[model samples]
Target chain A: MRNIIIPAVLFILVITFVALNLFYITDNASRLDAILVSASDAAKNGDFEEATAEVERFKEEFSAVGKYLFAVIQHNEVDDVIFSSNRLLALCNADTKEQFLSEIEVTRESIKLIRDAEIPYLENIL
Target chain B: MAVAVIRTVILYIIIVFAVRVTGKRQIGQLSPTELVITLMLSELAVLPMEDMQKPLLAGVIPIFVLVIVEFFVSAVVLKSIRLRRILNGRPMPIIENGRINQQNMKKIKLSLDELAEELRILGSYDIETVSEAVMETNGQMSIVLKEDYEPLCKDNMKAKKEERKVPAVVISDGEIQKEGLLKAGIDKEQLKSILQKNGCSSAKEVFYMTSKAKNSYFIVKKEKKQ
Candidate 1:
């Protein structure tokens, strides 16, 4: 009885943990992408002040969940997201409109990749 | 440095617990599936211990998953004979009726030298003396000696012998063992009487003591410090 119960409880816990990780990465990635898109739009409209504030908020948000992300996601993938976000922040601060917009796309793609990898898509599994 | 130390401690505890849960099979006695799990557990634990950047959960989650899977599989395998045979290969006969099964030996990739070495280890210098020898699933050899070559016992000589209980160590290096006292069916008071009878002032004066049956004991006094 104990043998069955222990493994059963652990199986449920592991499944729950994996599900939570998938949901967390997916939700966080979408949130971060939205923030980056907002910043990119602000930069395009010549609103450097709003764009800088939004980029700062994006960094804050990423940092807030960085530890959790690192726990579930691969270190290299998480590191890539961090690197690209920092670059995006620098471009926004320098008021380089075109470069900042392109950097936003790169940052968003990296964040999305992390979430995508968590998903058990056939291509990813293969 | 602190993180590494803490992670090492945690992983040590986890790995020990995992091994304990898996059962008491020695490394050489583990089945193929068990061997794989043991290898995977060590590999998973070492990664986080060496790399502080890798989250401990990265190792822990997979370890738990593997342990759970192994546990569940073993339970299911117990109820299913086919699964058991599939996972842990059936024991093959290497030698039967004093004749070696060369075909089975070849299938298992057991060379003649290896068989000779195994037989030698089993104290069987002559293969013809063995009635049966099985190659177990865990890769150990089990040999049964032929009746003519079997060791002579009291039954063969028609001799009567008294049955005796195995002696349990009651004292070792001046320390009393409670479990040993129980095993020997003696209490502390009886132990004290036995020690007094043996001319020992106390347990500390004794280096080794064993009790067997009622009022039956063996005692060895500690040597004087040089």
Candidate 2:
């Protein structure tokens, strides 16, 4: 009885943990992408101040969620997003509209890749 | 440095726990699935230990997932004979009725030389002596000798032998073992008399003592320091 129970409990725990991770990465990725899009639109409209604020907010949120992400996602994938985020922030601070907009797109894609990797899609599984 | 030390300790504990969960099969006795699990466990544990940037949970989660899967598979296999056969192939009989089953041996890829080697290892120099020889799923050979080749015992000679109780150590390094005395079926007074008979004043004077029965005992006195 104990033999069955321990493994069953652990199996449930692993499943729950994986499901929670999928929810977390998906929710957080969309949130981060929304922020990047807002920042990109602001920079395109010549609103450097709002764009800078949005970029700053993006960095703060990413850093907060990154601690959790590091445990679930591969360190390299999470680090790639972190690196791109920093680059986007640097471009935002410099008020480089053209570069900042493009960097925002790149950062958003990286975040999407992380979330996609977590999803149990046929393409991703293969 | 401290991070490495802490991670090593944590991973070590997790690995030990994982192995314990898999049960007490030795390396040589592990089935194919068990061997794969054991290999994967060590590989998974070493990844985080080598690269600090790799999250510890990355290593831990997979280890646990594998353990849980293996556990469930074992449970399912227990109740399903077909699944058991699929996972662990049926034991192949290499020899039957003092004759080598060449077709079965060939099917399992057991060469004649290998069979001879295994038989030699099992104390049978000649294959003809083995009435039955099976290659178990764990890869060990089980051999049964023919009636004429079987070793002679007391039963074969029709001799009667006395049943003797296992010797229980009642004293070790001058200390009394209460459980051992109970097993030997002797009380403190009987132990004292046994010690007196053996010319020992007390248990402290004896180095080792064992009792096979209530009155039967073996005692060795401690040597005086030079």
Maximum-TM-score candidate: 1
Error of 1 at B171 (Å): 1.7
Which ten residues in a row are the worst by lDDT in model 1 chain B? B1-10
Docking class of 1: incorrect
lDDT, candidate 1, A1-126, per-residue tens: 578999989867866777777788789889998999899889999998999899889989998888887776567887887888888778877889989888888888888877776676534432
Error of 1 at A56 (Å): 31
Using alpha carbons, what is the TM-score of model 2? 0.56
Root mean square deviation (Cα) for candidate 2: 11.9
Candidate 2, which segments miss by more than 4 Å at Cα?
A1-126, B161-178, B187-210, B217-226
Cα lDDT tens digits, model 2, A16-49, are: 7777778888999999999989989899999999
| lDDT score at residue B151, model 1, on the 0-100 scale | 94
DockQ of each: 0.03, 0.03
After TM-score superposition, the amount by which residue A110's alpha carbon in candidate 1 deviates from its true location, in angstroms, is: 22
lDDT (C-alpha) at residue B162 in model 1: 90
